[model samples]
Target chain A: GIQVEQSPPDLILQEGANSTLRCNFSDSVNNLQWFHQNPWGQLINLFYIPSGTKQNGRLSATTVATERYSLLYISSSQTTDSGVYFCAAADTGANSKLTFGKGITLSVRP
Target chain B: SQTIHQWPATLVQPVGSPLSLECTVEGTSNPNLYWYRQAAGRGLQLLFYSVGIGQISSEVPQNLSASRPQDRQFILSSKKLLLSDSGFYLCAWTQYGRGRTNEKLFFGSGTQLSVL
Candidate 1:
């Protein structure tokens, strides 16, 4: 089993501000992803970057596999972006089950 | 397009009652299915996973169980629900790969369960 830790357990930002969320894993992983859990409890996939960098609209993620860390960046934050962001990883040797971090709760104000 | 469906978006049941949640996937074959539970304001916990039909693996020892009776259908069941069973249950599926490199899960909307 792999352990995941997220930094800045809580974050607050004003509209148009930018924030970065980090995820650290206890071991190497073959898959890494960033997810946004909306207020309605729907988990939306943001990025599937086991390594390298990827961007989707105002969201982008980068995973450094060797260092066992990943980062999620939200730029020009909007009210709709207010939610819990989670990072999950799957170790190759494991049973292909995702180990999720506690999540970073984000709040955006108008 | 691939899509995952889960039923009874919300449920409320009395303690000790039997529980069953169903999840199905479309547009794919021989997909790997998973069941997860999330407590209020907590991270997701892996409950069970199935690599193929009739093959199930439990990640945690709990009151719940899971079965894959068909290729695209996975079911989570419990003989008797406990108060601790109250949580948001999510069903997800992904294509099988040689290793984790090809592992990427797509989750359903999830079911919120409340046990009294």
Candidate 2:
């Protein structure tokens, strides 16, 4: 089993601000993903970066598997970006099953 | 395109009542199905996962159990519900095959269960 830790348990930002959320895993992982749980309780897939970097509009994520850490960057944040950001990872084991971090709550005020 | 369906949107039952939640995946065959629960103020926890028909693996020791009746259908059940079983239950699926990297998962809308 692997442990996942997320930093900045809570965050508050004004519209148009930027933020960076961090996730660290205890062991080597072959799968790492970032998710956004909206107010409606839907687990929205943000990024499925096992390694390297990926960008989707205003959000981007970088996973340094060698360093066992991943970062989620939110740029020009908007009110719609307010939600709980979660990072999950699956070890080098056979399955893509993942263990999740507690999450980082973001609140972007308009 | 693969999609997952979980229902009902919410449920309320007595502490000793039996419980059953259903999850079905469409547009895929032999996919990996999973059941996850998100407790209040906690992270998402993997309850059970099935790689194929009639196979299930539990992640944690709980009063709840899971079953894969079909290649794309997963069910979570409890003989007698407990107050602690109340939470947000989510169903997810991903591509499952030999040497295939199923990095991303598609999640269902989720069901909110409250055991009184």
Candidate 3:
């Protein structure tokens, strides 16, 4: 089993602001992902980066597997981006299940 | 593209009542399927996972069970639901891979179940 910790626990931002949420894992992970749980409870997948950097629109993620840390960056935040951001990881190889962090609740005020 | 469908989206059940949540995947075969429960203000807890048809594994022990009767379907069941069973249940799937991510998971909208 792996331990995951998320920072800030809570965050508040104004529209057009930028924020960074971090995830730290205790062990080496083969699978790493970032998800946005909307106000309606939809766990929308954002990124899958066990290592390296990837960008998707206003959202981007970077994982340094060696350091066992991943970061999710939200740029030009909008009201629609307000939700719970989660980081999850799988310590084993393919087909393994994920262990998720508690999550960071982001609130973007218009 | 692959998608997962979970229902009834929301449910309210009396304590000790039977529970059954179904998750089905489309446009994919032999994908690794998983069931997770997210408690209020908490993290996602892995409930069950299946690598293939009829091959199920449980991550935690409580009052629930999972079955994979079809290649693209996974079901979570409980004969007697407990108050603690109330939460948001999610179902997801991913392809088999050998890389850092292996394959990214696609999740369903999720089910909000409240046991009274």
Candidate 4:
């Protein structure tokens, strides 16, 4: 089993600020993704980046597979961004199963 | 576009009661279905996964069990619920891929289960 750890377990930022969340995995991954769990307990997929970089609106993600780490960046954060951000990974031989990190709680104040 | 439906939105049951939560996916075929649980102030944990109909895999040993009777339908069941079973249960689906590759996981609204 692979281990996924997320840093800065708790984060508070004022609106219009920027933040970065990191996820480190213990083994090589074939799949990695970022998710946002809103206050209502809905999990939304943010990015599917096993490697390389991708930007979606004000959110972007980069995964360095060789380093076994990934980064999620939120730019000009808004009040709606207040929630838990999670990163999950599936090791190369794990098939489609993904092991999740503890998640980073982000509080964006308006 | 694919969509996942999980219900009921919230549930309350006494210990030793039976529990069943249903999840269905639409607009896709042969998709990978999964059940995940999130405890209070914790991350999501994979409970079960199904790659196809009648094919199921359990990630951890717990009081619950999962079944995939149909290609797009998944069900989580428990014969005798425990207080520890109380948590937020989420259902997700992803595009099926070969060779162990995986796509993004799209989740349902989730069910808040409270076992008293």
Task: Please state the interface RMSD for every predicted structure, separated by commas.
Answer: 2.3, 2.2, 3.2, 1.9
Model 2: CA > 4 A from native: B97-101
Which clashing pairs does model 4 show?
none
Give the docking tier of candidate 2: medium
User: Which parts of model 1 are misplaced by more than 4 Å?
Assistant: B97-101
The deviation in Å at residue B23 for candidate 3 is 0.8
Considering DockQ, which of the candidate structures 3 and 4 is the better prediction for this target?
4
Clash pairs, model 1 backbone: none
What is the lDDT, from 0 to 100, of the residue B9 in candidate 2? Answer: 99
Docking class of 1: medium
- What lDDT score is found at residue B101 in candidate 2? 40
* Predicted complex 4: DockQ: 0.76
Give lDDT tens digits, candidate 1, residues A1-110.
Answer: 78999999999999999999999998888888889999999998888898999989999898999999999999999999999998998887755668899999999999
What fraction of the correct interface contacts does each predicted structure contain? 0.60, 0.71, 0.71, 0.97
In model 2, the number of clashes is 0
Residue-wise lDDT of candidate 2 within A1-110, one digit each (tens)?
Answer: 89999999999999999999999999998889999999899999999998999999999999999999999999999999999999999898866468899999999999
Error of 1 at A90 (Å): 1.7
Q: Candidate 1 chain A: minimum summed lDDT over ten consecutive residues — where?
A: A89-98
Model 2: per-residue lDDT, tens digit, B1-116?
Answer: 77889999999999999999999988888888889999987899989988788888888999999998878889999999999999999999877733344558778999999999
Question: What's the lDDT for candidate 3?
Answer: 0.89
lDDT of 1 by residue, B12-116 (tens): 999999999999999988888899999999999989988888888899999999999999999999999999999999999887622232567889999999999
Task: Provide a comma-separated list of chain B TM-scores, one per candidate.
Answer: 0.95, 0.94, 0.94, 0.96
Q: Each model's DockQ? A: 0.62, 0.66, 0.60, 0.76
Cα deviation of B101, candidate 1, in Å = 7.1
